[model samples]
Target: MMRYILVGILALMVLAVGLLSFEWYRGQNQAVAFGAPFELVDDSGQPITEKAFQGRPTALFFGFTHCPDVCPTTLFEMEGWLDELGEEGEDLQAFFITVDPERDTPEVMKTYLGNFSDRVTGITGDPEKVAAMAKAFRIYSRKVELEDGDYTMDHTASVMLLDRNGDFFGTISYEENAETAVAKLRRLINEG
Candidate 1:
């Protein structure tokens, strides 16, 4: 009886391993997918969609123009990285999507982004649409009321890297090392 029980356990273990291996193989063969559908406008008020992110690697950042530090710093860093990459990064695109659409309109976005590389475009639109887009992109954003009855925005500070097919590849933290950031961008360009 003990030997029979041991054999039964062995058979179950083999069956489990086979099932796990099949699932793993299926997952490996599945295509990678990320984010949801979104429709917004660029700084020029041009209708932009998820299709813009396709056909090339993209550096996507979400922040408000009113951002005191993180937004401006990330924009500057992005410009530098793009400049550093030169021709190699020509195919790489950068987009700045506003988390505070109430105050960051197309005009505001265009003027603000003017300080950075023209290669970097700004995206904004109706508040509800913008919120939906942000949600679909899995970005976190909230409004903070100040003592002056004013307001500020708290949002994600990382720059998301997307492959040529617009799949989420990785991210560069707000203060990620310059060298490391550049390396990640380089890898995205080459691999995507």
Candidate 2:
């Protein structure tokens, strides 16, 4: 009986150590996997992969057209920065990807994007594809049912910025100013 108890304690210690090691490895991997490879369609109906956004630094935002506030506000802010960029911002690409692929068709995207600058490309495709792309970027989004029986999307409100070589660069806050935003782009473009 004494021997059995000693062996059992040893086994439990090994198991606990193994579980801790696994958790440590997983945490490291997830942070490194951000902005990994993805394949999705653009607003133009053409399928775009991670490679398409290469050759220029890109800013990516995931949101829905029906969003009453943050989505449009963020887009508008980014558009202002892009517009003010002029020739300097030409090498920068801003993307507005839709989380609500069901209602945000290519036409709908174009019309909605029209209110913003043409520099921001709208991306939408099959629902599964959209979800996969969001996953690759580590974006969170959910559907909330409203009292009117309709629903709205609650999505991650941050924008991801990638370097010209398609590597994970940094992020842009919705409240960032034009000067700070422009500085980030210039740095990324120069780095490339």
Q: How close is candidate 1 to the true structure, as a TM-score?
A: 0.86
TM-score of each: 0.86, 0.80
For residues 1-192, write the lDDT of model 1, one tens digit per residue. Answer: 999999999999999999999999999866545677778889998999999999999999999999999999999999999988989889999999999988998999999999987998999988998898888778999999999999999999999999998888899999899999999999999993
Model 2 is weakest, by summed lDDT over 10 consecutive residues, at 30-39
Tens digit per residue, CA lDDT, model 2, 1-192: 999999999999999999999999998975676665666678888877888778888889999999999998998888877777778878888899999999999889989998977878899988988898888888999989999999999998988888877778888787787789878877776775
Alpha-carbon lDDT of model 2:
0.85
Question: After best superposition, candidate 1 residue 39: deviation in angstroms?
Answer: 1.6
lDDT of each: 0.92, 0.85
- lDDT score for residue 62 of model 2: 92
Clashing pairs in 2: none
RMSD of each: 3.8, 7.9
